[model samples]
Target chain A: MTTGTASARTRLDPARRRTQLLDLGVGLLATRTLDELTIDLLAERAGISRGLLYHYFGGKHAFHEAVVRRAVEDLVAQTAPPAGGEPLERLLASMTSYVDYVTANYEGYASIVRAAQGGHEALRRLHEQARNVLTDRIFTEDAQGAVIPDTPATRLAVRGWSAMTEELVLTWAADPGPVTRDQLLAAVTGSLPALVDLLR
Target chain B: MTTGTASARTRLDPARRRTQLLDLGVGLLATRTLDELTIDLLAERAGISRGLLYHYFGGKHAFHEAVVRRAVEDLVAQTAPPAGGEPLERLLASMTSYVDYVTANYEGYASIVRAAQGGHEALRRLHEQARNVLTDRIFTEDAQGAVIPDTPATRLAVRGWSAMTEELVLTWAADPGPVTRDQLLAAVTGSLPALVDLLR
Candidate 1:
C-alpha cells in the first residue's frame, strides 16, 4: 500500500512531464545563462532525481538544444502574420508583434541570442531555421504578395534586414528609452521598403 | 647570483609587461571564451605567478573588461578611415578594411561580440563606445561629410546599420560561401545610401 501510494504520487504522463521540465527550464533561463544551467540545479528545482532528469533529457546539451529550438519556434509562432490583410499591413503587423513579443520576453530573447553565439552546430541550425522562416515570410508572402524570386543576393539582403530588426529590437528591449517604441517600430517598418528595393 | 638571474629573468618594465600580458590574453581569446579563460592558465602560459597576474588585473572580471576594451579599441583603430579621399570612396574603403579586419581577426571579433552578450555593464558600455565611433565615422564624416544631427532616431538607425554590417560580416566570415566577399561588400556598401535616405 505504501509503495503504491509513492508511485502514484510520483507518476506523470510523459508529455506532461516533458512540458513541466521545459517550463522549468524556460523559467530558469530568465535569470541564468545556459552555461550556468546545471542538471543538478534543474533536477533539484523539478523535484526529481538527476537520473530521472537524464532519463527525460539525455544530457544538458540536448536539453539546451531542445529549449532553444522550442524558444525559436515560439517566437516564430508569436510573430506569424495575422490572416487576410494587405501584404504591407501584414508585414507591419508582424514586425509590431515581434517587437511586442521581444519586449515581453526580453530574458528569453537574450537567452536565445546567447545560445546562438555558443558555437554549437545544433543551436546554429535552429537559429538559421528561424531566420529562414522569417525571411521566407517577408520575401514570399509579405513583399506586396507577389513572390519575389529568391537569389543569393536577395537572401543575403533579407537576412540583413532580419538581423537589423533583431539587433534594434534587442537593444531597445534592453534599454527601453532614447527611442520610443513607436519610433523604433516606425524605423524598422520604414526600412522594409528600402530592403525590398535593395533586393530588387 | 642565482637570485640575480631569477630576478632578471622575471622582471619586465610595467608598460612592456602589460602589453605582453594583453597580447597573451588576446591570443588566448582566439580559442577560449572569457568564461573559459582562467588566471591559472594565463599565468602558466606567461610564466608568471597567479598572484602577479592579480597584481596587474585585480581579478578575472577586471581582466576580461580590460581585454574587451582593448580589443574594441584595436578594432576601431584598424578600421579608422585612411586620410583624404572622396567621402563615399573612403566609406567603401573603410568598409573593405573592416571586412578585411574582421575576416582576419575572426576570433577577436567573436570575443568582442560574446563579451557584449555577457550582460556585463562594462562590456556593454565598451561595445556602445565602439558602435558610436563607427556610427560617427559613417554619418558625420563618411556620408559625403554632411553632418547628420544625432537625434535618437538617427542614432538608432545608424546603430541599426552598424549592427546589420556586423551581423552580416560575422555570418559571412563564419560561413564564407553562397555570397562572395565582393558580393557581400557590395551589398553592404550599396545599402548605405538607403540607410542615409531613411535617416533623412
Candidate 2:
C-alpha cells in the first residue's frame, strides 16, 4: 500500500522498518507534542502493520523507551571524553563534541528530554541510566584526568559544569537560531579553567 | 454551598479562591498527567463554581497559565540575590534559596514544566519571562556587585552560574530524593572561587 517513493517500499526489512519507525516518531515529535503520538498513526505512517510494531517492541511504551535509550546512548557516545590529552584540553574537547552532538541531534535530544519530563516509567529509567553514565564519565575521565584532586571542591566543580551544560543545551534546543553552536561551545570552554581550579 | 472547617472556610475569598484552585491544580498535576487536568474537575475539587473560575481566569488555559506564572514568579523572587553581599556569598545564598524553593514546590514546578512542554504558548511566555528576569538580576545586581571587572569573562561567569542553578533545580524537582538540597548548594558554592577566576 506504499504510494510515494521507491526507497520507501523495498526498505522494509526488520532493521530498516525499526529505523523507519523511529525516524517517523522523531519527526512527528518535533512538530507535535508527545501526548499525541499514537501506535496506530506511527504504524500507518511507517508503512508497517500494527502487528509488526508490537512484534518488535511489544507495545508503544516499549517502542518509546527503545527510542529514548538509543538517543541517550548516541548522545553519550558522541560526548565521550577524549583520551591522551591534557586534562583541561581533553575536557574542552569533550565539551566541543557535546555541543556538536546536541546541535546536530537537537530534535532527538529534545524528545528524550521531553520524555524525561513526564513520559513512561521505562523512559525515566533510560534517562537515569544515561545520566548516571555521563556523570560518572565526567567524574572519572574528564575532571580526574585533568589531575584535579578528588576533593569535594573538584566534585562540586564537575557537578556545576554538568548542570550548566544541560541547561544551556536545553535553552539552545528550544530556539537554536538565536544561540549558535559556537557560542555554546565557547561558553563551556571559557568556563573550564575556573572549574579545573576548584579541584586543586 | 461552603462546607468544612475553619481552614477550608478561610479560602472563600476571591484571591484565596484563585490560590486554592491553583494549588488544587498543582496537587492534581502530580498524581495525573498534564493532559488530564480539566476545568470541570478543577472546579469541582476546588469547591468553587465554574462561573467563578472563568471569571477569575477566563478559561482553563488562562487559569493554567496564571498558576504557572505565579509559581515561576515566586521562584524568581525567592532566588534573587540580596543586596550588599559579596558576589560569591550572594551567589551561594541565591543557590540555597533556589534549592529550597524547588524542593518546597516540587509538584507546582513540575506542573509548570509539564504545561510548558505541552506547547502551551502562554505558559512558555511566562516561563521565559521569569528566566529573563533572573538572568538580568544576576547580571545587573549580582555581577555588578562583584569585585572583578565587568568583562566578557565576568558575564560568562554569571552565565555559567545561572545555567548551573537552573539545571540543578530542574533536575532536583524531577527527582528530589537522590540529591539533597544542601549538597547542590554546597556544590555550587564550592565551585564559585574557580568560576570567579574564569570570569576575571
Among these predictions, the greatest TM-score belongs to 1
lDDT per residue as tens, model 2, B100-175: 7766666556566655643566776786677678766766764445544455545455555666766556665666
Query: What DockQ do you compute for every candidate structure?
Result: 0.25, 0.20
- Collision pairs in model 2: none
Q: Taking the tens digit of each residue's C-alpha lDDT, what string does model 2 give over A1-200?
A: 56667865664577876776776776665455455667787888877788878987788778777666666766788787777777667767788887777666666576666566443457767776776787677668844454555554454555656767676666655565544466666666766555545334
Go through the candidates in order and give the clash count of each: 0, 0
Which residue runs of candidate 2 sit more than 4 Å off their true CA positions? A1-64, A119-122, A140-160, A170-200, B1-65, B83-93, B103-124, B142-160, B169-200
lDDT of 2: 0.65
Which pairs, if any, clash in model 1?
A: none
Q: Give the candidate number with the greatest lDDT.
A: 1
**Model 2 residue B16 lDDT?**
76
* Model 1 chain B: lowest-lDDT 10 consecutive positions: B142-151
The digit string of per-residue lDDT tens for model 1 on A72-150 reads 7777888888888876677778889999988776776676775675446587678878888888887667445343456
Worst 10 residues of 1 chain A by lDDT: A142-151
